[model samples]
Target: MKIPSIVFALLFTSFSYSQNISGKAYYESKTTVDMDNFGRRDMTEDMKKQIKERMKSFLEKTYILTFNGNESIYSEDEKLEAGDNGRGFGMMMSSFSAGDQYKNLETNQLIEEREFFGKQFLVKDTITNLRWEVGKESKQIGQYLVIKATAYKQVDPNDVSMMRRRRDRDNEEKNEAEKKEDTTKVEDPFEDLEIPKEVLVTAWFTPQIPVKNGPGEYAGLPGLILELNVDRTTILCSKIIINPKEAEAIQPPSKGEEVSREEYNKIVKEKTDEMRENFRNGGGRRGGGGRRFGG
Candidate 1:
């Protein structure tokens, strides 16, 4: 008995749809700390470890993307936990795409445009406040197309309390005659306060996928972003599932502060500087103890 041409075509389509490709995304990124204008401070072994851990945390945070004619969903899960207790901080981000059941529920949503990295680009209105910028180049990730993008991290220079600490120290140096007897030190409440300059990042995206989205505040690519690099850290797409055997179910996250990509960078820089200050002042326990303990 011969099958009808329509029936054969249906079977072929089903077979093609059933095929699921899986693989791991390997990323090698360089990280540098701007210590002085002369050059960048190389990342120490401990610093590298910390960066990897941070990337692991970022991946643990979820971001979503959608494509046209695809009812499927894509996501990544960071397999690492918080803290520095061994277990190696690593991540595995995956994507799922398939039938209408798996399609994005908000595909009709409008794409919003904002200025990022000195360029006009598109992003989702839900996350319009986040800063984004264009990158300098492009590359391929598996079968998907990818382009590079950049974003800035800003720093706030007006943290008054930190400045007060500096004034307290200056007052200690004044001679008795130079210092007014009745005058209380009016501390300049902005010393010791540092704001990080805007940092540039490069990311890889594929415009054909039709989603201007990525992890953290980085977005506004012509296509779905597959990989990104900011400063020295990186985030990459590991696996994608288009048309899973099971029903596709994806729930986009609504938690997290919505800041422009620039604002986001500023926050990170401020916190990082604060932490480094704490470490330098011997206020917090240093990681690895700088080789004193054979770390």
Candidate 2:
């Protein structure tokens, strides 16, 4: 006598959920940059190459997500190298990096730690329920069969990390003329920066995991998300351990002053505005190196 397909599925689901399962997922994240489109137009290819090499740490990263059925903790696997103080340009890019994040599916909550300009902030926000358009397309990621889902997520306007330089020479000339006309008025440094209001996010999840969790603030999937394509970044799950012999507890970060996500973004905008203004006014001048900016 053969078991009914629906009955077998039900039994399998029940058995999978009944166990106290916990595991870790290791992810490799890579973000691509069009070197030609960034920085100054006069920048040589060798200069761009050097800058890209310096930015490798920020562009390529690894993270580990420790998760169970209801909650998960996602954090970077920090690797300390000699002289890797994350200084200079790396320091500027570090503002875009996210710290440890904790998500609770049952409560629909997201708590994350973010460091901006040397200040640590704990951001608390509700988990956004993405309107995923699940497709029939499927692929194999490792041993699990994963299905594709796509959604358009609203981009945070004050997210400086998402900002890109608008390559408009006319606008630059106009700004320069205006600056010359009115030396007293400080120009808005963000005038040339552009960030899209929304970005398409493509995700792949495996129903076999039976967990609604993923890296960063992405959640609400039917299963564990194995890969994500958001903006210019591609995050892929490199390895997964289900029910390891020892599992670390998923703990929410408690350090730093607590603030809502909106509040934090506001603070970041204000601080960035001040910093940009200062830099424009020669606040970043270095001795022996002369002024970093030209009049």
Candidate 3:
């Protein structure tokens, strides 16, 4: 039996595209920081070095993205915490960290679990749509040939973790009476921190892989994103596995109290504000051991 060439080509194409495609991408995420930004000019050089070293565990982390066609799950790869791990820092910083995140490209839905302080909240929101400017530049990330893309993302104002502390200024013009009055008024410790309205995001994606997904909240690229650079942090794919024997089930987190993203942010801000007020009123120990970041 002679098969027509076009028919054979069609069959081959169908076979190539028909199979259920699933994979896992491992990413190494790291954030670069300026030591001076810690706002600890009083610390000696050795003290600053020690602080940086301790911060390595928090600044550098591993994450796994499990995806199958239209759905994906991104979560930190679990590892035992070191005995000397910065417990206070972890508790404080983690309040700002996102837990397991699930994305449904088909429906444009985003579900994320977050543990703010000790309370759990499930943030449900629509997936962010990034207007990516695809570039002609291409590079090799591992075996994948990735092309460049850039976009600007609006920074959430309430996201204290992403905000940086503004440099303090001495008000030489203020009279002693004014200074005394200021001291009497309750002040927000995070008042100096600020997040820009928008920040540029750079991404590297490979068309060879046909999934429109990536770590964190980024997606909608023509192919899978292998590397992402945003806000002084770079998330690079260390490894990729296509069609592994055991496919992780993509499931949205459902345990925490469901709240919209805005609501969740408001909750965090309120709690943080209360903490700040307690600290200013000398009720810090009464509020519990002062676990604070951005000092």
Candidate 4:
């Protein structure tokens, strides 16, 4: 008679979790600005430095997570009243920003508001619950004990959307041409272009929180997620406010063109392609795009 490895591991991690835990979790999210990824080859050294400065305002950001039981709303805490983190030029910088996301584990639903080219989209779809491989290893995050979990997420390898990176005008025009396919044939509305996907996600959750929720699209753990590391971006929880005096109403975003995730992605692709066309033909400065939220 012998105890299996999995059973022993589970028994070792069976710490007494907390009870009646509910509250707000403050997470600080930071992203790196990859200059080469922005597709600016002809940019001078001075120009590159300037672009980094402007993008810095967005790369380092703060987000708030409000959760009670298995429901949560994750959104950016832009400190709008403070005004662009005192970066006066942020108002004139880029026009598009990511939207807030809300998820409900009880209903298996998700409602996210994504902003693209100044247009808002209500992305209504069921939550993509990732299959996580839990490990026996454990570590202490603050007062709670957390175990490791790993998952793989399919992502566009050439996706420059994160942090709203720049795309070259010529490349976009070339892509559009490729869509035309046969030169002698009529243009095709769609192309069979295949996008590569590559991304690995690592998350650590604390059983003490005891909720299957986390920041952004991450959830489905036996506990609360305290840290999420995806690619070059890091979203870490800095503080947990349990049972706040007042809780904000947790509701899905109602405004914007109601559409599914796939539909919204299509809309974004079309709008972005059009923007590149204008830029290639020297249509002047872009007019659309603004902060995701304004205080």
Candidate 5:
């Protein structure tokens, strides 16, 4: 006996919905270190060149976001690979709404719309504005409907460098000029930098969750972004857990760097340089001082 067409369709739909959506989100942020008057004053042309070369040699980093609503909990696993320090991995769990807020977990403070690579990203922001051009593509992510959309934005390298240098100089001046230091004051490093005006970035997002949120600085989509790629890295939503059986509360991460995205990048760069220098001076074991994967 042949099955009815409607029954077959229903079965196919049910099977599709039963499959959980899971994927990895990859991001490649390109940054240029300029030695011009706007950038690092102490950096020589050769040093800048070396820095650029080092950055170019970096491998892509991976972050995993699992969403299963049925479980009533949420968790995230981030694996950072490459660099001289080897491999490092971190696991974080929180209430489903944990990533939705800017909270401090461990030493890492969550921030929102922090600028990195000359563009603004919505990390843990209550409000965000992300604009993208509509495209003609549709794909299925689990049981939910998905549409592919693209957006283009320019990134300014000059702004990043200048902002970094200004922050550095300001910090130094403050440290030396103040007779009485007020360590309680919180400083925003990107205050002096203007919005970026060069270098175009394109991104793809899917609107299924009906929320304008995504990993990093991506937002403003009509739905949840399942897959995103720009600057040569790709981020795809592999699995989503909605309303899980037992409801594991998704807690925010406890250990990760917390700063404006730009500040974070600067810190990473400085740390990398320090490690490299230590290795060169034989003060650290070879390949041991730098960032290691799965740390």
Candidate 6:
């Protein structure tokens, strides 16, 4: 006997939703900085305000984390980008963060596709083994029960993002070399020369979500991370969906030139250092430009 078309459709729908418990989580992230640390001694208050307002996109962002039980992909959501036709001179900016990341918890491996200055890099490396100390504190985020966890993370002071941001904000007229000698306080707020860098990370994970995942390189938890705060940035999971009608295949990104994290770091440093040398010699600095991506 042949099955009815309606019955077949119902069975297919049930199978699709029940096959794997995949989910898409929406997160809202924001960053805050103290501009006074940059030695803006001569700037008027109005100038500072204008600069801050224009930097909202960099300070605030939206990201999406799609995951299943064993694998996940996290990426920034597309937004209306402010074009450069009218940004004026010296306003060019480039993103230091690269590539959509794919992670496999079973093997402790990660594939991140990174792009810098029209160059593509597929970064293959091990996921950071975060040592999370779970606390007895508990709270409620929406409908999920969350528990607090603390971690002391050692930050890489020479990361490309730090240099790029400082370069972007540095004034061409100022002598950075001379200013570096003043050790009392940070003469260049935009520069990242301070040592002993570390961040105290506080994370909230929900046991209901049963996935060892979080936003942007944070994981190895018993449950899904709902909220994370580190230094000036905060990533908070605003929405969650479990086992929807459509099953998403969390595939690893494989479209860039392969390289390791150490290699990529070296590449970024050389490029940045070259740009700085050119600027000092009056050949005009490479502005890193804005949002360069090469497949």
Best-fitting candidate, measured by TM-score?
Answer: 2
lDDT of 1 by residue, 77-180 (tens): 33334444331112111110111112232352322232222223333333322355544455668986565555554433532111111212343434333435
Rank all candidate structures by their lDDT, best first, as comma-separated numbers. Answer: 2, 3, 6, 4, 5, 1
Candidate 3, residue 35: the lDDT equals 69
Stronger candidate by lDDT (1 vs 5) = 5
RMSD of candidates 1 onward, in order: 15.5, 6.7, 7.5, 8.1, 14.4, 10.3
lDDT of each: 0.39, 0.77, 0.75, 0.67, 0.40, 0.69
lDDT of 2 at 100: 92
Candidate 2 similarity to native, TM-score: 0.82
TM-score of each: 0.39, 0.82, 0.81, 0.71, 0.41, 0.77
RMSD value for candidate 1: 15.5
Off by over 4 Å in 1: 1-136, 151-195, 245-247, 252-295
Instruction: List clashing residue pairs in candidate 3.
Output: none
Query: What would you estimate as the lDDT of candidate 1?
Result: 0.39
Q: Candidate 5 lDDT (Cα, whole model)?
A: 0.40
Off by over 4 Å in 5: 1-62, 66-128, 141-144, 154-206, 254-258, 265-295
Q: After superposition, how far is residue 275 of candidate 6 from its true place, in Å?
A: 1.5
Looking at model 3, residue 194 earns an lDDT score of 62
For residues 1-295, write the lDDT of model 5, one tens digit per residue. Answer: 1223433344454444533433223233333333463333456888666544444433233344433211111223443332443211100000001122332222233453332322333343222243566555665665655666565555534222312223245564454344247544333223233434432334444433434445554555544566666533556666664435564344544334344545545543554445446444443444544543232
Q: What is the lDDT of candidate 3?
A: 0.75
Residue range 1-295, candidate 2, lDDT tens digits: 1222432353467456735768999999999887766655567999899778877877788899999989999999974232353433455566554789999999999999887655677899999988887776778999988878899999889877777656555665566677779877544445556778988999988877878789888987677899999988999999999988888888899977899988988987776666566556654433433323111
Clash statistics: count for each candidate: 27, 0, 0, 2, 52, 2
Residue 215 in model 3: lDDT:
92
Per residue, candidate 3 scores C-alpha lDDT tens digits across 1-295 of 2223433343455444424778999999998767675533356878778867776776889999999889999999964253464333434464565689999999999999987766677999999999988776778888877888899999888876676555453532353345467766543445445677788999988766777799998998767899999987999999999988998888898968889989988877877777776656763434455543231
Task: Give the per-residue lDDT of model 6 (tens digit) for 1-295.
Answer: 1223433343454444433568999899988767664334578878777777666766688889999878999998865354442222123244354669999988999999887766778989888877788776778899877888888887665564533223244553455545556533322222443323667889888756767788988898767899999876889998998888986888899987898878887877766555554444433423434222345
Worst 10 residues of 4 by lDDT: 186-195
